[model samples]
Target: MKILYAKDFNRVLDFLTINLDGVTLAFSTAENDRSFNRHKDYGINNLNSIVKDFNINNIKYLNQIHSDEVLVYRNDFENITDKEGDALITSEKECAIGVFTADCVPIIIVDDKNKVIAAIHSGWKGTYNSIVTRTLEKMIDEFNIDIVNTKIFIGPHIRQCCYEVSEDLKEKFIDKTNIDRDILFKGRNLSLEECILKDVREFGIKEDNIYSLDLCTHCEEDIKLFSYRKSVGTYGRLFSFAFIK
Candidate 1:
């Protein structure tokens, strides 16, 4: 795996791309790049140019309603612009998929053997609804991907140290998933990463194949990544993209 940083439109961005079995899979973070924001139309245009620099064509994005919905991208699927979903999966090499997040988790899954890649946006609602597990299940049922061989990358998000949630929300995760309350909650705070990891492991993804950046968006003040909790209003979003070349 190689980490690289570049300037896009005068804004610095960091990308993590890995070459495995002759396929290049990558995800990126917006480092002090406020222009990469996804909420504004200009921000989306800026993101398109940044993705273009990666030599990716026809990048697919979602309306991202924070639901458990996952879209299986196919060449025949039309209206990519209006698609509303939180996750996207595709085996087509011509199509690259990405998700936007500020403090929410951005997950990328790759099946190198099958050349299938998926991009997931998992917020608290999506996580509580088992979005990652659902996406993996879709890959298995539709694409026949080997869960054990699939590589999962959990990108930068708000970590447990700064991801404090309400007691009701913490209880919801514990009671709903049957995960240990002690494991999910620490002093009235919930660990979203741990919750997602627990579900992924339960789905039979190998421990070693699962990797996490473990960088907290809220804590990394010097990194200049956007954080909704840090600044509720006027905060930007970080884009995590993945595709097979």
Candidate 2:
């Protein structure tokens, strides 16, 4: 974890970032007192500070709706506000694509071989509906990205340890995925990371290329992140992004 001080906002920006093959990947962590977000409904307002601190430019992002929608950027960064999607993909250089999340999963897929990258917001709904699956498929088909050459970074989110859900909801996921109910449930808690991994492997991505962090927004004692459940809808959001610059 690294800290970036945004003097303008007086924010102690704690975040993690890594660069691989010209693409930069990052996510913001917050103390319980404040949020990293600023937008109201749908826009890049929330990403302004985070992007600036990272020195990222030509930003492209989405007004995530927790759906399976995936957008392929085509110089339409101007119309991002109208785009209601959970994932954004592009091969454009000097532009960063991103998504916002609290307890939901933030995923960044990088295909350096083909110069394609994706930023995905996968909440329970998006996970159940296979948002990442759709995004990967789009990248493979449209961008001609080779799955084997791609590396995935799973950012901070509510892990099974803190992501307790209704038994009915757990059963619902089992019914939808046909995945062993026992494998997904840890005494009424769910592992979104597991769900995401199943889809990643099914797409032929090797485990060695997939990197996931164990940080949980709800229960992370160190480098705490904003949690929707923990804050009861008053929580701030984390911004996850990736791009070639």
Candidate 3:
């Protein structure tokens, strides 16, 4: 199964959406999908609007900290927007779990069996710590999932094409991950996509099960996809969510 454009995307807020195997995934475009951002200048919290548009109430979100922390979603989870974590996994149906990103990678994961789904925020730090793999391990522990049958989807983020980094940091990443140096680094620029693929593959996920939207947030400034590297102060974030319908 593939993640395709929703036929009704334009009918709603123009967010990119796709449904497959009884699951619905939605991602925001900076143009029309302005989600909850707390910056007073950008004050972009449209929760009521999102609920009205998507018709999902038990939407779980996180206050990401660029760490390897992952959570198992619960009905009584409190201070959700203030909770500290980088990933969420659940087997629950209809309730959407989401992550916010601005130049950081947003990953949506599903079991090949279609019994579980996950949302992750992987920044440079989170990627270095293998947040994706951690989430997958959590899925295995919580839902008895098989890593080989897992499908991972990568959303828009800074790619090697424009994700230039410091020499020390690049060297550190090169030393931390087992991915090929050439594939992970493009002359000091990092590929969050390749790094994630390497991590997932290490756990036996087949190449066919991995897909990336392949949009470069840093390079898509004109497209207005909320790139923190491309924006001045007071930038907003894009929301990416998924649920098993």
Maximum-lDDT candidate: 2
How many residue pairs in model 1 have overlapping backbones? 0
Q: Clashes in model 2: which pairs?
A: none
In model 1, where is the ten-residue run with the lowest total lDDT?
1-10
Go through the candidates in order and give each one's C-alpha lDDT.
0.78, 0.80, 0.79
| Backbone clash numbers for all candidates listed | 0, 0, 0
How accurate locally is residue 176 in candidate 3, as Cα lDDT from 0 to 100? Answer: 86
- Tell me the tens digit of each residue's lDDT in model 3 across 128-201: 99999999999988889876777888888878898999999988988888678898888988888777887888
Candidate 3, which segments miss by more than 4 Å at Cα? 1-12, 33-35, 38-44, 112-114, 221-223
Alpha carbon lDDT of residue 237, candidate 3?
81
Ordered by lDDT, highest first, the candidates read 2, 3, 1
Q: Please give the ranking of all candidate structures by TM-score, highest first, separated by commas.
A: 1, 3, 2
Q: Model 2: per-residue lDDT, tens digit, 99-182?
A: 888899999999988889999999999999889899999998888899879888888899999889997898898888877777
TM-score of 2: 0.88
- Which lDDT value does model 3 have at 225? 81
What TM-score fits each model? 0.89, 0.88, 0.89
Model 1, 80-176: lDDT tens per residue? 6478999999888756688889899999888898888899999999999999999999999899998768988887798888888887887778888
